[model samples]
Target: MLNSNLLRKLDMQDLMVFIAVYQQSSVTGVSEALFVSQSTVSYCLKKLRTSFEDDLFINTRTGMRPTHKACTMYAHVLKILESINLCHAGPATFDPTRQAVTFNICAPEYFEHLILPRLLKNFDFADLPVIVNMHKLETDIPADELRDGSLDLVICFGPNFHRSHPDFKSQVLVEDDLVCVFDKRATPLEPRFSLQAFVERRHVFPTPWTSTTNMVDGWLARQAYKRQIVARANSYSAALKMITGTDFILTLPRRIQKLLAKDTIFNHCEAPNGLPGFTLNMQWSQNSDPDSANTWLRDQVLKACAEQGLS
Candidate 1:
């Protein structure tokens, strides 16, 4: 059997006063401990006794003594107080080494290839594993994913990207320009190719991952030029492989060119005719803007970029 009316009258403050009186053995003692006046403690104690329908404490020759009911309720009240304290304390500090946190980052294949190795090499994930799920950037910003917490962050090129989502926060992670790559064995022995020679070569161009328009072609179109495309590949790796043992040349980001050319025999030079460069930026939902774990993840990325000289 429960007392509904008594439940309404009882509150956290009442419980605190009763607990303080029980522990301190006197209202005046409770007042001194809690830095409240003796009258305030008495008022709350009176309410608590009315709520319980019991003389919760009685004055004795030595001190105030808790009744049987008060003694029975003391443990429950202490637990409730501890829970209340926890609730008001805010979120705990994030410890990556102690807590497992998975970070979801979206990027194009090129950005993934360039950043993943560097990020893993620099981050010290010794105790607890930090998982990173990398997804390819799409033609449109995944606003629903960002809002709903399905995705944690995105890194991609295009300054105008994510402009539609005002709640999305973004920072430039790296800047890179376009460069032309071709097999050193097949390319003409020249310091640099003229714009005419650049356009004349059979090009192995990479198709954009999520868009129909080729970014390289779009850039060339703005300058009233077009390349003789021999084939189109879906990713930078595919495009890089297609040009191997052939005269076909691939135009790609300078950083990506350097990374892919590490093992492969390739010659690279600045793209002819002053091709446009792009900046890759990292974006996260403002919903996580104040989250400590997300902030640490972003910092790790910035550190990786710095180590790679991309920042």
Candidate 2:
């Protein structure tokens, strides 16, 4: 249980002081980071201690060390403070043409390959100072990142993860048909995929946890079809690399196929008659802040995709 009064009394300034002290292990370091007097930093520390009913920090030869309780509470405190800061910072009034802002995005590598080139071409980040950090969908928890303010947005397939998190807002950005890719030189007798061919062929698939894989398997099961999954990888870049000059056929979104077309290492074919298309969505967390910068970012993405004639 938490003390609501204590929580209500804390603010971003307090957390900033706490984090600076925690990191540099000294009140002087905190004062420098916050551009405040040492006494002000010391005063904030006292308030934190009184509110939490904990020593929180202790002086040591190393400077100041956090107590075990402070260590345990660090992450939660940091996230809360960040949320407060974002809300208060107001709608990023900085003009996209003249201001600089860093945004962190979590997405599949294939999504990155498909969108990055167009995003850079359409949006002039030179003045905006934009930085994108791409993380593997399979390796990171995007919803958690969005909630904690570490991730500004997520572009991913399926709604499973975001559907349950109250803090997130999601919209279907595009719906793409699944296509099978293989070496163009190695053509099978059938121009279109067949259930028997699907089951018999050596298949390379993005990792089973990927929304595409889950949707494909679910569709196959509905149609009473099952394929031998020969390989599972987290990224299409990895899976496609594996399929080069080989007979392995991989099922992926058409957008991914178009992106890979540049490499000429493999070519794409349509899935057998029964498999269904999947929708890719963009998600962001909701904050009380009046800043509509996040919405602007999402609009920019959609506009970029439309300009490229990619739905």
TM-score of each: 0.72, 0.62
lDDT of 1 by residue, 1-311 (tens): 56567768777777788888888898888898888899888889888877878998999988999889989999999998999998899777678888677888878886677778777765544444778888777787777888888888877677664346788888998888888888878867666677778888899878645765656777778878788999989888888889888999888888888777744588887677666788888888999987888888888889888887888
User: Each model's number of backbone clashes?
Assistant: 0, 2
Candidate with the greatest TM-score versus the true structure: 1
* 112-228: candidate 2 lDDT, tens digit per residue: 776667787666544456666666566335667787778778887764532456666777767778888887776676767887787788888786234533777777788777888
Task: Give candidates' CA RMSD values in order.
Answer: 7.6, 13.8
Candidate 2 overall lDDT versus native: 0.75
